[model samples]
Target chain A: MKCNRTDIDTETRLELEGALDALTAPEIRPIFDKVVTDGRKRVTVDIHKVTMIDSSGIGAIVSLFKRIKAEGGQVLVIGARDQPLAVFKLLKLDRVFGL
Target chain B: MNAETKPSDAGEPTVTHVTFRLRASLAHRSLAIGLVSTLVEHVKSADRDFRNAITTAFGEAFNNVVIHGYRNRTDGMLDVEAELGSDHMTLRLIDDGVQADLSSVTPPDLSTLPEGGLGIFMIHALVDEVVYDSGTRNVLSLTKRT
Candidate 1:
């Protein structure tokens, strides 16, 4: 998977493409962690190009959501599709993320 | 050359072969699913039982390899192969990664509600048989009988 970082003022947007699975979760984790540490109040993760997600990928997203939410920040996932979207729906994370 | 054929072998049933070579990374999981689903759909009528069980098992096994075996490495390729027969289907996944000692790796105790440890258990539960061979490479083989 490929990830691009875009920061504009207070919102940090992480745009992701390709498959978010076990192999690529680590590459994106540190960025989310840093955003949380930087005290960003609103983070937008763009998954427009993402085509699939598995448990590990879901775990990574969940970890980021938890961390950012703990700091009273909001995390929004945009443009999730196919299996990744099914997973979020299955786990009821859609309600949690308000996506 | 196109017309040359063995008449005796013509009566034998044809077996479907499917293969995919994808870089062992999280982003390829969707590709794997798409490929596997196509195979399942192709053989569903002939081998519904095997198709159902194997489709679930493949999801779990492929997910495990893509997630745990590759872990942080996104450079290696994962080779996936599946064969459909009259009575059964078999899936073989090959990956180059740090092979965990299958002997040393104990099955996670499922009674405790461990979060990440349920993958293997779920794989075992979904398929008729599951095998893991750890050596220079990690190869997972799963089979189901229809």
Candidate 2:
């Protein structure tokens, strides 16, 4: 999986493309860390390009959310497809994350 | 059915059991229709509850396979193994493109609006059991009762 970044006003947007499965998640972690270190309070992850997701990919995303929230920041997710959206809703994360 | 057909001859023809593999890109709007129709026909039964359960469980699993496993690889194949049984159904998913790190993938925090990481959580929540084995091959096994 490849993650590209763009700065749009106050939101730091992440564009994830390809498989975000277990093996590829680590490739995106550094970007998440850099975003947090930049002191960005509001983050938006755009997954319109992201195709597949697995448990590990989900875990990495959760870790990013927690790490960001610990600093009193907010996280937003955009454009989740079939399986990932169902996962978020089933875990009651739709309400938690307001996706 | 002949138990042993290993007559190793050039024209004897070795028969390998044919396994059906279906591939499609299903939109979110057709989630219920796609899942129910596909799974029921594959399993060859019309039990409402069984269909419901299979649809519910496999729906989440397939979603993950497509969206997460193959990363919605518009060109990816959702390799499925559907072993029909009298009491239960077993599905094994194999995808060469998506390699999941079974150890590190965890459920997102339930208390927050997670920007990500809920696929596995839902798969675990809806199915009787979900297992992931990763290596040269990435495999996901899901089971549901009739």
Candidate 3:
């Protein structure tokens, strides 16, 4: 998976592409940590280009959400469709993230 | 191209079987999933939900073998066999790695927003049956019925 980060004001947007599974989820951990360490209050994850996602991918997003929520920040997940959308719905994260 | 098609009787669906081997690693996960996804698409054709469920479940099962069973060792090899029918699809993943303690797995509390325990839970939720057996090699069978 490829992750690109863009910052505008206090919000950080992360754009992910390709398949986000066990192998590729770890590649984005550093970026997730940076968002937390930098103390960004608003974060957006765009998965429009992600063709597939597994539990590990979900875990990474959940981890980021938890960390951000703990600090009174918000994480917005956008562009979840197809297989990734089904997974989010199955895990009930669509309700939590308002996807 | 280890694919076989069996003749079906009247009013019965033909069964097609395909088997292949893959390197047990995270890098090779997409290939395994793609094969299953293609087979599901071929069999189910227009059912998007069915395709998603099988693809997701198979991906998780493959991840488990590579991450837990193989312990992230690339030296391990996996044999995957898929059976497709009119109303159901089955995938068998065989690996020569440490057997997973299936009894130890429990569903994560979704209310708590847990992260790590969702893989196994999702597999069970998406498929009709999941069976694992271990001896000389471990085999995880996932079947989903339409």
For model 3 chain B, the run of ten residues with the poorest summed lDDT? B100-109
Model 2 lDDT per residue over B65-111, tens place: 55666664777665666555445556666666677654334665667
For lDDT, the strongest prediction is: 3
In the range A1-99, model 2's lDDT, one tens digit per residue, is 788889888788888987675457778888998999998888988886775555556777778888888998988888886656655566665655668
Q: Write the per-residue lDDT of candidate 3 for residues B1-146, one digit (tens) a residue.
A: 49998889898789999999988988888888888878886575438899999899988888888888888476999999989887789888899888985523577889999888788899988888888889788888888888
Number of residue pairs clashing in candidate 3, backbone atoms closer than 3 angstroms, sequence gap of 3 or more or interchain = 0
Looking at candidate 1, what is the lDDT of residue A24? 76
Name the runs in model 1 displaced over 4 angstroms: B1-41, B44-59, B63-81, B85-146
lDDT of each: 0.68, 0.62, 0.89
Q: DockQ scores for all the models shown?
A: 0.13, 0.13, 0.93
Clashes of each: 3, 16, 0
Task: Show the colliding residue pairs in model 3.
Answer: none
Best-first order by lDDT: 3, 1, 2
